[model samples]
Target chain A: MSHVYERVALIGLGLIAGSMGLAMKAHGLAGEVVGTARSKDTRDVAVGLGLCDRVTETAAEAAKDADLVVLAVPVGAMGAIAAEIAPHLKPGATVTDVGSVKKHVVEAVSPHLPDTVHFVPGHPLAGTEHSGPHAGFATLFENRWCLLITDAGCEAGAVANLRALWEGMGANVEEMDADHHDLVLAVTSHTPHLIAYTMVGVADDLRRVTDSEVIKYSAAGFRDFTRIAASDPTMWRDVFLTNKEATLEILGRFTEELFALQRAIRTGDGEQLFDYFTRTRAIRRGIIEAGQDTEAPDFGRGTSRK
Target chain B: MSHVYERVALIGLGLIAGSMGLAMKAHGLAGEVVGTARSKDTRDVAVGLGLCDRVTETAAEAAKDADLVVLAVPVGAMGAIAAEIAPHLKPGATVTDVGSVKKHVVEAVSPHLPDTVHFVPGHPLAGTEHSGPHAGFATLFENRWCLLITDAGCEAGAVANLRALWEGMGANVEEMDADHHDLVLAVTSHTPHLIAYTMVGVADDLRRVTDSEVIKYSAAGFRDFTRIAASDPTMWRDVFLTNKEATLEILGRFTEELFALQRAIRTGDGEQLFDYFTRTRAIRRGIIEAGQDTEAPDFGRGTSRK
Candidate 1:
């Protein structure tokens, strides 16, 4: 099938944007990909790596005449990027994003958009612990879900075109309301990241565990937390700041349940602990069935530090 | 180097026991490896899989005339297994275990031990979500840690020999008082496992998450919890039940910390959350540098998860 857009503009060429640029180039999904970054060093590296056909320092300069524009900055920076590029965007351009939180993005960017263009807010549910243009790859989005959140009054044709662009990059696409999307993600992504970061931090502070012992035994369960905790601090800082209500709600529920389990352990309530352990197993099976993640072996690629 | 034990007997041929049997067989570290199981079906499976040279139903029967007898059963059953085998064990036989909790195992097994026999309680900090004899492999203990805990006047040479046996099975051996081991592990493993089980259970109880979204979006983070919660239910039940005090103490601290972070999020305390996130990244790096775990391309494996 022929590629959809003649020119694709990526504002903020970090991991997500650079990855999209690589996927677009490898799949022939975009005729020309233009990218911009906040720092000159990043733009130089992106240009050197050929992540895009052209690299610029300003969002508006990069978005000039582009058929599609993806706002790929951190959540807190969305409004600023939107404002910078609003005056330069081509008429009828389809604008979307690769942010983790959708409602916040919609609320932040929609007001700055031109009525002539299609604003379809999206989130590609994919990433690794690494960041920056150097960390991206052509197959980064393969087999992952790219969720787009838009409303009834928006241009359905434009949503279809954005969906096609993501599908061409090997991502399965789905749509949901912006608010529901934020809540779903707060459970699946945002809250979990916060909990993991907190747990790892707690372990780090415990004198009895000794930094050596904690790390040595991390494979038991704590290693999983570390991987998530190692994620970009700036990105997550914005995530929690913007998705506050949803994250706090889920986190509140998690603590209530965690305390109950703690009480069970203290009182030696084996039945309650056993029942909880058993119920959670079914969720893992469902994930396998959904074909959303790995089942038996280590969840990710198995390369470990020597 | 020459092999350590001439005849090694394994009591309870489940995942750890079976894996040890396979590792010994692969390395030719033992002249004969016999195993015991409570059920006839398990005995049959063990023999069929060649996990043992001889399979029996009674721990005493397996310990008879053996040079080394290793208890790899649920923690709750350790005392009974120790009592049953003490009288029948060969004079000078070395006994060890792979229980998660250490102090209880020592208390349960030490008093029942005959003077001629040496009892060294151990915990191999390695395993997968899988269970049963079929999950056994020779490499399961490779590069893993086996914490041996005891303060009893067991002979120094005896402990050395047991350490040799574990190292032969591809483990690094460390020593600590059983109580300290329990305290250390509660923070590192037990508390984390309990929290994971509880969080996933909470999601499971909510009808909205269970009907579909939780499983679909679990890849974002919740799936990691399921992988942990799926750990052998009986094994974890015994872990919490046996290591009650330490588990509860660490858990109390965790809830307090989790609550503080929750307040930070609710009140938009970005600095608090950011500091916690930043501090935790060092622990992951410490783990990699310590060689306790790997942090290469795909969790030390080659490629990333699909």
Candidate 2:
């Protein structure tokens, strides 16, 4: 791969940004990579890990001469960072974000960016329970979908270039409207995460079952819930807050369906539970067929980890 | 390891039974293992896969002359199978089960067995989404928990021998009351599986998001739910039906907690969501520390499968 951006500035040094840094270096996707984090410890760690060619104390210093600036901070912090770096952005620079919620990020950061800079909101549908700079690896985004939100007046060339960079780093990019992206993500990611968090919370709060017992017997199904619930709390909190309507909507549907199933269980309606479980099995087949996950047993966790 | 039981009979050759067969064979925990399934096709598959030394046509035939009889059928089927095999069980032999729900199994199987036989109910806290004889592996129970239920009248020697067999097959054995085991499982497994099935059902029913989109973008979180929801419909349906009281209790608690979190999301209460998520992260840490799961990124799926 060749350089798609002469200088790339990463505004936040967390899992996503650190992953992008390592992936870019591995694939030679950028000529120079510069990064900044709010904490000195994070910046020092990034520098020590050689995640970027240069580590700056301020976002402004990192974005001063960058052709592509990535706002990889929490969704709530996008506006402040964008305002700080707006005046320092180079002419015709492209500013993209990797926030989970796209519309809120566009609303938060768009007004602060200069008109010369292209604001393209993006979200890479890839992550693990782990976070932080050390949690990233070179192939974090391999074969994962990166959804890009393009406004009507956004430059096609800018979008194309940004997509090329993500592709070079091993992601498949697709374009969607901001509202649709938020809604779709609420269905696919946000609500599911919230539900996982809630389930794990319920397990934790059960007084009848001891905590050690829950942990000991978790390998059956609750272990998966704990993994998702273990995700970065601040990032997920912002996700639910920023994507409130969509998350609530999906939650509403989830509650209704769950209530119906609960009724079935209470009523001893084996047919209803069987039909519902059988239908969901087909969706799992669809996911395996789409290559989003493995068909290997136990989510491939038992075989490999053991 | 030497043989703990001279002859072991596994009734209902599914994932758990088949796995027990393989693990027992691998560790030489039983002198001879015989299995029987309701379906001729299942028995044929067990024989073809070498999951057992002999595949019998009836539960009675499998139970005859067996020193250890394992009822590995679904909880709902235990009563009928027990009645069929009770007449054939050897004197002084130990009869146990691998049912997910134990209180019901004890009630169903204990009465049918003669006083000479020691009836011990058990539940192995291990399985994958896949089912059938083909899904069996020798290491499925390695490092996983197997809860054994022993009443006051149960023989200590019988319990100790059963524990030795499980330990020899690479499982950690624990003892708990039948009702407590059911309730704990309701919290750890049954309710989680039901919620996963409901979530996947909601995703499939959503009109706005295409099935392709859900499957393609599932890597974020929903993929885990799908893997869990893909579990055997018959087994899960039986679990929900047989363990109705405990499962419903957990479902009631789950719904209450979920509604609270849903309200928090609607009211823009980031603090509540953050606290709940943060607390749940501690449980995940406990599971990892308990060695029930790995802290490897992406559930260790990406590194091993890719």
Best by DockQ: 2
Residue lDDT tens for model 1, A203-290 = 8878444646777777777777788788888889889989988888788788888878778887888998788788788877887889
Give one digit per residue, the lDDT tens place, for model 1 in B95-153: 89999999888888889989999888899988878788887877888888888875768
> DockQ for all models, in order?
0.58, 0.69
- Write down the TM-score of model 1's second chain: 0.95
lDDT (0 to 1) per candidate:
0.83, 0.89
A14-119 in candidate 2: lDDT tens per residue?
9999999999999998999999999999999998887888899999999999999999988988989999999999989999999999989989899998888898
Alpha-carbon DockQ of candidate 1: 0.58
Root-mean-square deviation per candidate: 2.2, 1.6
Lowest lDDT 10-residue stretch of candidate 1 chain B: B297-306
Q: How does chain B score by TM in each prediction?
A: 0.95, 0.96
lDDT of 2 by residue, B81-197 (tens): 999999998999999999999888988888898998999888889899999888888899888888999878889999999999999978899998999999889988999999899
RMSD of 2: 1.6
